[model samples]
Target: MSEKPEPVDYTYTPIGTIHSPFKDIVGMPIQPTGARGIRGTIEIRSDLKGGLADLERFSRIILLYSLHRCTGYSLKVSPFLDPTPHGIFATRSPKRPNAIGFSIVRLVGIDDCTLTIEDVDILDGTPLLDIKPYVPAFDSYPDERSGWLGAVAHNAQHAKSDDRFQ
Candidate 1:
């Protein structure tokens, strides 16, 4: 029998902050795809600004951010789009052990360490953990199956966030 390795604890300091018009969670779009053309800004810390070099080459970027406003968590949750309950890992619900939110947004422009972005779904003043350039070849999977989401995927286009996840 193999011994399981004990998990080590770690912490992450936000490399930047995301600024958006959605000050409150009541009416925000639930996902990037649903928030098409919504303009927002990301302010990278001055020390991390150097990492922004060449990021502009990509038309989009993936943002890993902390759901700072969302508190507490439930292992099983009813996501914003679906009424049925699902395991926290099964849905992209913000209520989780880590409270991390992943969003991909269009990179419109860059000014020093600040970035102009579109298709944003995160809340204003959210703490950003990291950014990665989106590449279709690597990130896109046209034929992938979406499991339970496949049935209600269309709802995403018209769904707006509410206080359910808060």
Candidate 2:
């Protein structure tokens, strides 16, 4: 048998901070669909202001941020839409091995280092890790299956987060 490779650690610096209306995890929308029209702002670091160039061209942007408040992780979790415990990788549980989460929000406008965004489901004061322009042709999959989520995915539009993940 082949030997397993050694694990390596990496470091990341926050490029900015995400500000949202939801301060607490309780009662906050679980997904962007539920947080539709909710406005928020991203305060990019002054040093990274130059990176914002031509980013506003996209109508939507994918935000990868750190789940700062999530303490620990579980291999299985009962997500907001369903109470059945599923593999953490199968669900978008904030409690992950890396405590990282991502959201695709509508880009409203950008001024210097600040970006006005809508359909935000993230918590306030979340550390912004990275941002990528959303391209439908590349991100959308018309024939893709969502496995277990297909049954309860519709409820996401109304589902709200509880203290379970915390």
Candidate 3:
């Protein structure tokens, strides 16, 4: 058997920044559901503006961003919706080996290199890593298990984020 390679550091220059009214982690929405109707703007680098071509064709988009403000990590975290702690990978906790965040947001409009979006749970000035059109036909799955989340989902609707992971 071949030997596994050693881990190496990786660096990514932000392609853009997500701007929102949320200036702090306190009182912010824990997930997209709680952030519904909240608007934000994406300022993409001028050189990458062309990548937005035909993006308007989709009503919703997926945002991949860096949790720039999350400082540390934990193998088990008490997710916003539940009091019991779960494996870090099993949760949407921003504190992880790589502080990357994902969100499915409504695309309101686009103007040049900027995009207007709604239902944003990301923090203001978060670094945007990538964006992809959310195709419901390919992404939907009615029969999926949510594990412990299933029983606690009702709490998610009203749960606001705090500095628990930050």
lDDT (C-alpha, whole model) for all candidates: 0.92, 0.95, 0.91
Residue-level lDDT tens digits of model 3 in 7-98:
99999988999999999998898888888999999999999988999999999999999999998899999888878889999999899989
User: TM-scores of the models, in the given order?
Assistant: 0.95, 0.98, 0.96
Per-residue error at 85 for model 1, in Å? Answer: 0.9
Q: What is the C-alpha RMSD of each candidate to the true structure, in Å?
A: 1.1, 0.8, 1.0
Q: Write model 1 residue lDDT over 124-146, tens digit each, in one string.
A: 99999999999999999979998
Q: TM-score: which candidate is best? A: 2
Q: Which ten residues in a row have the lowest lDDT in candidate 2?
A: 76-85
Instruction: Report the Cα lDDT for candidate 2.
Output: 0.95
Q: Residue 9: error of model 3 in Å?
A: 1.9
List the candidate numbers ranked by TM-score, top first: 2, 3, 1
Error of 1 at 152 (Å): 0.9
RMSD (Cα, Å) of candidate 2?
0.8
